[model samples]
Target: MAQDADDAVDCGMTVGLYGRLRPYPWTGGEGGADDGGEELRERLVNLALSRAEAYDWYAPAGLRMRGGRSAHPVPDRWFLCDQGGADWTVGEDETGPARELLWMRADLPRRIASARLPLLPMTRTASDALHRAGDFRLAALRAHLPLHVTAGEADGDWEDMRDWFSLAAPAPTVTVRCAVAVSGEETTPPAWRSGGTAAEVGAVWQTLLGEAVTVAPGAPPATSAAGGGVRYRPYLEPARPVAAYRCRVREWTADAAVWLLETAGEALRRTGHRVPVELTAALA
Candidate 1:
């Protein structure tokens, strides 16, 4: 029988530690099946909480539902990270079960309002490829980002940023902005290539981005679709994280892009403009 996607709760909270999305474990893999459902959930929650402990410096250790009302919000597939050797937890309180995971939210204000297009390589570790890239791109676009009317500290204000951008353009729109796809040239790569780590990948990506910008400093011809040839593909990592397991391919679209296109596309669809950018960078 085919395996399920795993019982996990994907809370797409645009503000919490996970920064718009967080998942909790619920079921063990094929080998780690549990007969007790609630017990299993509690176990996952404890695991996530344990992982959150490392992030004591980032934010609150974990997430807390206003009243701890969710019965079982844990997911099955556990996302693990090796940064400071982190892990997640599911634990029981006098009332019931709760789940939490570790993440950094210091850059959230910059995240919500700016445009970010990231090409991420899936790995065996837990450091979020999206968040890491998103934070960088947010910084890049901040100067050009449309400013809010009622602005306070631009770094920490999420609601005001969202509201201001909403007035400018409404539907969710995320342009690829810029992309770098990586590929290996070897006829047969190693079974589990360990030449680098997540931090290393982030560094290399930033370096290359700096190079690309330097290479194309001047604006491209007016006819150019993605200004100065904005769309690019680099040799990213392989499709499989290992020899047999396929790694997920992720694309980081600009948050503002997602919001802008969302509203414009819907309106244009009625008139049959049929925007084409939506289908170009589908994140594999």
Candidate 2:
């Protein structure tokens, strides 16, 4: 299940913490199953509240705590998160006996995003391999891709930096502008592509951009698309035109190129475009 969650993260899917609560068995204890439902519900609610409190520092702005029975009839799944304005009460499931079982969920993306960080999905296997090989620098580099870090901040000490990276908190205010071209023609970037279909690419882009991307018909020349021509600039809104932003982008791009070559070499090679070694190195 943890691996499944990690895979979802790697695939850029939003995941939430989930758990189930049920009444204690009626083994002639102090409180029987019939009477224990409400107690169990309270305990579960308290547990959720405690977790929310513990993670409060990482919670997103405008976060509101909520709990309640789901409206759906089949397989009731309740949801709770550190963010959003949905407030629900602890109630009984519709299909089954009142308050027999309950479920709760808490989203992770909200907390991460609230900290102004990018979601760089990684698999457990890859993480484990990097740890075993003691490639902490590369691991840290890949972990915070599209985000720049100072030399003394995160790169100096891997052991201490690991904890900071794990929390994904206090991230630098930086935005990633991806320029991807495939098959020597102007097409969607690799990050947005799943099976190279227009619909799939557009959907992914829309999800990331929070708006539809305008795609012009007809293909441009190969010379124009030689090195991932400027498709679109996906940047953070309310951006300031400061020199620090440019420097951070230059640093991040150099590191990202190296990381992609080292980690996603095969994937990049399959795209049929020559790797921009000069471009990546020029920034360095």
Write one digit per residue (lDDT tens) for candidate 1, span 137-199.
221111101111112222233334335443533233233332111123343233213234223
Compared with the true structure, all predictions reach lDDT values of 0.24, 0.24
Measured by TM-score, how close is model 2 to the native structure?
0.21
Worst 10 residues of 1 by lDDT: 139-148
Off by more than 4 A, model 2:
1-33, 58-284
Model 1 TM-score on a 0 to 1 scale: 0.20
What's the C-alpha lDDT at position 203 in model 2? Answer: 36
Clashing residue pairs found in predicted model 2: 67-88
Q: Model 1, residue 198: displacement in angstroms?
A: 42
RMSD for each model, in Å, please? 19.7, 20.9
Worst 10 residues of 2 by lDDT: 238-247
